[model samples]
Target: MDKFPIHIAFNFVFLRKKITGIRVHAIELFRALEEQKETKYIFHVITTKEGADILNEHGIRANGGIKVHIIASSFEKETDRLKLQLFSLNNTLKQNRIALLHCFDYLTPLQRPAYAKIIATIHDLIWLENPNTYSLPKRLFKKVFFSHSIRKADALIAVSKTSKESLIQHYGHGYDQKTTVIPNGLRNTFLTIKKQGNPERLIKGEYIIAVGRYLPHKNYERLIKAYAHCNTKAQLVIAGSDMDKSVDLQRLAQELGLNDKLLLLKNPTDAELISLISHASLFVMPSLTEGFGLPLLEAMSLSTPVLCSDIPVLKEVCENAALYFNPLSIEDMAAKITYALNSSPILQKLIENGHERVQAFSWENSAKQVMNLYDDLLLNY
Candidate 1:
């Protein structure tokens, strides 16, 4: 009963140091799938030098059915002009003669080997939702890339049910059947059965925490503006990477005379994040749009009281475990945060509900679903 190795390429080319929901999804799912690492399935992970370190930590190496290929750069820029290589995947596809190419990011190669079946994980159709958040080039690239990949891909994995529906609604025709809703899962550390958090880098006193990179779609600016109006005395701590680069979040806080009350920690390590989340009085998710609100689930897992946007994705992830607010209305967000912090009964209920809600999501569960999808896709091929 000898079985041939099925070659599959994991497109981690675009992963950078900045921690986003996509990076978390890819790494966590892979970690869960790592338990089944053997010769039955060959994993060709194409990634950058930094990404390799993350993968290597999970007992992943080139010795087994896994082969790690480190590239110099994901994609070389030529004076802001887009290239056809599409994260340098086409050549890799052709050279490796890959049977199935799984794209963790939103993009797939514009040109790839004919035999290669593409399975792209679409996080969200945020570009279609918020045209102003992206520049003309990015918007155009996303529209073209999304359309081509959705139409061409053998199957698409949407991060949430809402994301799946968004694909069908906007992309239209031949999308609903192919797209599968596979929600992101939390790390074991966050589970109440395990440990809520590791005390790595401790920030003093109680604080209201929010985690996300400094991106326009993340809606940090509005959150900061809302924080100014809140009556709560809790420190506003934003543990996002590269906040100093993307937007002047600190200066915004300063303009509102919140210099002492606001703490902006850039690129906090995972242990630090766990400590922050576990100890926080409240965790706020003020995203204008998201495919799946991973942070909301993470907060719930850590037993932190959740105050987030009333967006469908956030609701879908946290369910009734969170207090909701209008993402657009700064006043609503401020009021919600203040109320959540002040209300002991509600916050306690959220923490209790959080423990129960998080039981449904796990890396193991997500990995199982992914393996099932992989088996089905490979069976046809």
Candidate 2:
């Protein structure tokens, strides 16, 4: 029998701004899938002009068997943009004969072609888990739309087991049956790129690094306070996109008398980030909650000792590879940072374990599992 043509359509309409975890997951996963010679599936990406431009900027071009479809739309208003994408997506999927539609972001189109199976990847349930991070209106919108999208999906992929459990707890036990845990993987660049010197000179001397957007869940203020309490000369480098929260963090740093010690790099490029993490004394993830901590793996791949919050998902991701600190306790965080910086034995052990832990996660493996899931779903139909 002739092999079936499995044309997978990935919806990237939600990616309008700077690159985030969700956008990275989609791009890296697609790239991995493209490299799979065993599975002859034609990949089609549906993204906005801005998203397409960003891909192009990263040298992610459509060639080989992969194709890119740009959807021109206005992003002035959230609701209006979503509406435009939904209407346009329905037409595009039909015209392109999309066999399966994968929504990289949590939400999916309310109306889709009947012939295509829809798969939605849920990175986190921040709105439901930590309501304080989002406004009431935005939370309500996500609750409604996300619930609908999950219910409509033919299958759901969770980035971590914590996320899958969260879905079951909030969305009910039915989700447990359909949801599969396929953790996110590092981009090939992160795995193969050589450690380059800090070209920007962002760090003066020994420094600790943390990466995340300026969100309350990221707990940057607490991380700063902990750093101030630690007696190390190492600087605290917080690198992420500057949302409005950065101003508040700067104010907090001043209040804590850590203005001189805290360095905020707003949205560093991938190469710059690699350089920063590669040379760091330690990489810390102070997030209160995460679906999966990708940076921990990135830091580990770089052979940087890891220190992170003692949260369930972090524990699941880091396993025995990192030194844990109580996220809510400044003293605990401080002590852990001090130990990680001063103790060479602990640091060396962590680096060794980190490299071993990181080997289990690869985009190639992740893509193969996703492709197998697609095949299983198609066979059932």
Compared with the true structure, all predictions reach lDDT values of: 0.79, 0.85
TM-score of each: 0.91, 0.94
Q: How far off is residue 162 in model 1, in Å?
A: 0.8
Score residue 357 of candidate 1 by CA lDDT: 89
Residue 69 lDDT, candidate 2, scale 0-100? 90
Model 1 residue-pair collision total: 0
Candidate 2 overall lDDT versus native? 0.85
Q: Residues 245-264, candidate 2: write the lDDT tens digits.
A: 48888898899898888888
Residue-level error in angstroms, candidate 2, position 273: 0.6
Candidate 2: where are CA atoms >4 Å away?
1-3, 37-40, 195-202, 243-245
- Tens digits of per-residue lDDT, candidate 1, 1-381, equal 123677888877666666777888888787687775545788898876666776677455676667888764443452211342264667877777688888886677778887778889989888889777778988887888778778888889998899988888886857888987787888654554335335553877778999987778888889989999987678989887876784477778779998899888889767778888878889999998988877777788777899888988888888889999999999999888888877899999999988888888888887788888888887856
Best TM-score among the predictions, by candidate number: 2
List pairs with backbone clashes in candidate 2.
none
lDDT of residue 80 for candidate 2? 64
